[model samples]
Target: MEDGFNIGDIVLSKMGRDSGRHYIVVSTDENYVFICDGDYHKVAKPKKKKMKHVEATGSRSEYVAGKIAEEAKTTNTELRRAIAEFEGTENVPVQQDEM
Candidate 1:
């Protein structure tokens, strides 16, 4: 967590293509913060010193909770698939290579 922003805090970007864009704080270093917007592909590491350009818009506790729930669902599904494979009832799911 940074001195000014906590992880999972929602914020609005004030500059760049992400200007006025809403994002959730994911991490912070001494001077920069990592954020994830609705678009996971749009994650950023912006400088805290320049954070004046950003505004704390809201809290992402609920959003985080939703993400946790989604992850749990995926994990459960994977476990079930694995069990099915072990029981010889289904083929194992393929693991795709990362691009």
Candidate 2:
């Protein structure tokens, strides 16, 4: 596993109010990182969390990295989709009610 996290890295919150939640690295500083889930924490309002509070999931989103590298605008839908894809839940069919 990588020792450090970079932009677009997927991480799981190990400690804090958002513990046990998954987030993507939106930005980072020397000791803190900005994370978002595209739901509670949107890209526009990424939560600033200590680096030690999150555990790297060892999975990364190249699509997100490319967008960040290109300085392109990202949306919450995209973030949610990326997370679902990474977790292998994107293809699961939603159950529909029989009316």
Candidate 3:
């Protein structure tokens, strides 16, 4: 299909006994994909068509990325606060070199 998976994406199978199984995409050529479904005891191999229907598992990585972004925001804010306190002023003077 035109919407087949790309490399490095995680997916969950939606049919057969493999239903609800999670897999990681290893590679793809045309209509099939090489995948590793850890929970299903499947190692890296290209699966057959229609036997494995998968949906992308992007939410897991997205949630982790969002957490990292939040942490970065908190760290940036704290650094600004620390600089302000060290300089004994709420606003620090900007340097032309820094700009």
Candidate 4:
């Protein structure tokens, strides 16, 4: 199986408070990737997590990939919508700040 992660790729968190959550890879380096779920981690502020901490789901979002490729502005709404579409859900509500 192709286990590599790329921009716009959906992943499942294997660790942390967000464990078992799905997120999109927004950025990456050799050892880490920045991920956002639109709910917990907004696209504007992705969370940098270790690559080993996430498991690649082998699914990708073309919309998110295009946005990342073009460096276009992304909002939480868009992220939520994309994720919801990928998950076959009606809609994904924005997460409230827990502070």
TM-scores vs. true structure, each candidate: 0.49, 0.86, 0.45, 0.85
Q: Which stretches of candidate 3 lie over 4 Å from their true place?
A: 1-4, 42-52, 59-99
Best-to-worst order by lDDT is 2, 4, 1, 3
Q: Write the per-residue lDDT of candidate 4 for residues 1-99, one digit (tens) a residue.
A: 223889999888999988998898899888899999877787767999999999988789888889889999877776777777777884546554433
Off by over 4 Å in 1: 40-50, 62-99
Question: In candidate 4, which residue ranges exceed 4 Å CA deviation?
Answer: 1-3, 91-99
Worst 10 residues of 3 by lDDT: 73-82
Instruction: Report the C-alpha lDDT of model 1 over 1-99, residue by residue, as the tens digit.
Output: 225876656676777776865655555666666665433223222334355656775555454535444653222233233334434556756443222
* TM-score of candidate 3 on Cα atoms, chains taken together: 0.45
When summed lDDT is taken over every stretch of 10 residues in candidate 1, the lowest stretch is 73-82
Q: Native-vs-model 3 lDDT?
A: 0.46
Among the numbered candidates, top TM-score falls to: 2
Per-residue lDDT over 1-99 for candidate 2, one digit per residue giving the tens place of the 0 to 100 score = 333889999999999788998899999888898998787888889999989889998899899878988999887777787787878888754332222
Q: What is the C-alpha lDDT of each candidate?
A: 0.50, 0.84, 0.46, 0.82
**Backbone clashes under 3 angstroms, per model:** 0, 0, 0, 0
Error of 2 at 82 (Å): 1.0
